[model samples]
Target: MDDVIIPVAFFLILAGAVVAVAYFQSLRNRERDRQWADAMEQYRVVVERARTEQEATKLQLVEMSHQVKALEKLLLSVD
Candidate 1:
């Protein structure tokens, strides 16, 4: 009886330790997931801003090309 009781107590203690470790590990995983989500959101925002800026720059370049063409025609007419 004594031998059986001692082994049972030891098993219970070991199970408790395992549960504690698992709980802490889960918490760490959740925090890591949260940080990853935050980083992804930040990346999305930066990409969107870059796309918008690129479109604006394209529009400016097109307008400049049209103006330059008009100036060239004017110069040719003067000659």
Candidate 2:
């Protein structure tokens, strides 16, 4: 009976230690996930801003092209 009791106690202690380690590891993983989410959000904002700037640049180029075409037509008329 004594031998059986000692082994049972040891097993219970080991199980408790394993559970504690797993709990701490789970907390660390949660923190890492939160940080990754924040970084992804920031990246998304930057991409949106770049897309807006690119659209504005394209519009400006189109307007400039139209002005150059009008000038060419006027020069031909003068000639």
Candidate 3:
């Protein structure tokens, strides 16, 4: 009876330890995933802002080109 009891107790303790380790590992993985998601969101916001700025610059360049063309026409008429 004593021998059987010792082996049973040992096995129970081992199983409990494995469960504890698994639970803690899952919590760590969840935290890591959350951090990665936050980083990705920040990157997305920065990219979007850059795209908007580029579009504004392109528009400004187009307007400047039109103004230059008008000036050239005026100079030609005067000559």
Candidate 4:
């Protein structure tokens, strides 16, 4: 009976330790997943901002071209 009790107590202690380690590992994984999601969201916002800036630059270029053409025509008329 004494021998049986010692082994049973050791087994219970080992099982508890394993359970604790698994719980902590689960928590770590959840945190990592959340960080990944946040990074992806940030990346999406940055990409959208870049696209908007590109469109604005395109509009500016078009306006500049029209102004240059008008200036050329006015100078020719002066001559």
> What does candidate 2's lDDT look like per residue over 1-79, in tens digits?
9989999999999999999999999999999999999999999999999999999999999999999999999999999
lDDT of 1 by residue, 16-53 (tens): 99999999999999999999999999999999999999
Q: Which candidate is the best by TM-score?
A: 1
lDDT of 3 by residue, 6-47 (tens): 999999999999999999999999999999999999999999
Model 2 TM-score (2 dp): 0.89
Model 1, C-alpha of 51: deviation from truth (Å): 0.7
Candidate 4 deviant stretches above 4 angstroms: none
Q: Number of clashes in every candidate structure?
A: 0, 0, 0, 0
lDDT, candidate 2, at 11 = 97
The parts of candidate 3 lying over 4 Å away from their true place are none
User: Per-model C-alpha lDDT, please?
Assistant: 0.99, 0.99, 0.99, 1.00
Q: What is the Cα-based lDDT of residue 27 in candidate 3?
A: 100
Q: How do the predictions measure up, each by TM-score?
A: 0.91, 0.89, 0.85, 0.76
Candidate 2 all-Cα RMSD: 1.2
Clashing pairs in 1: none
lDDT of 1: 0.99
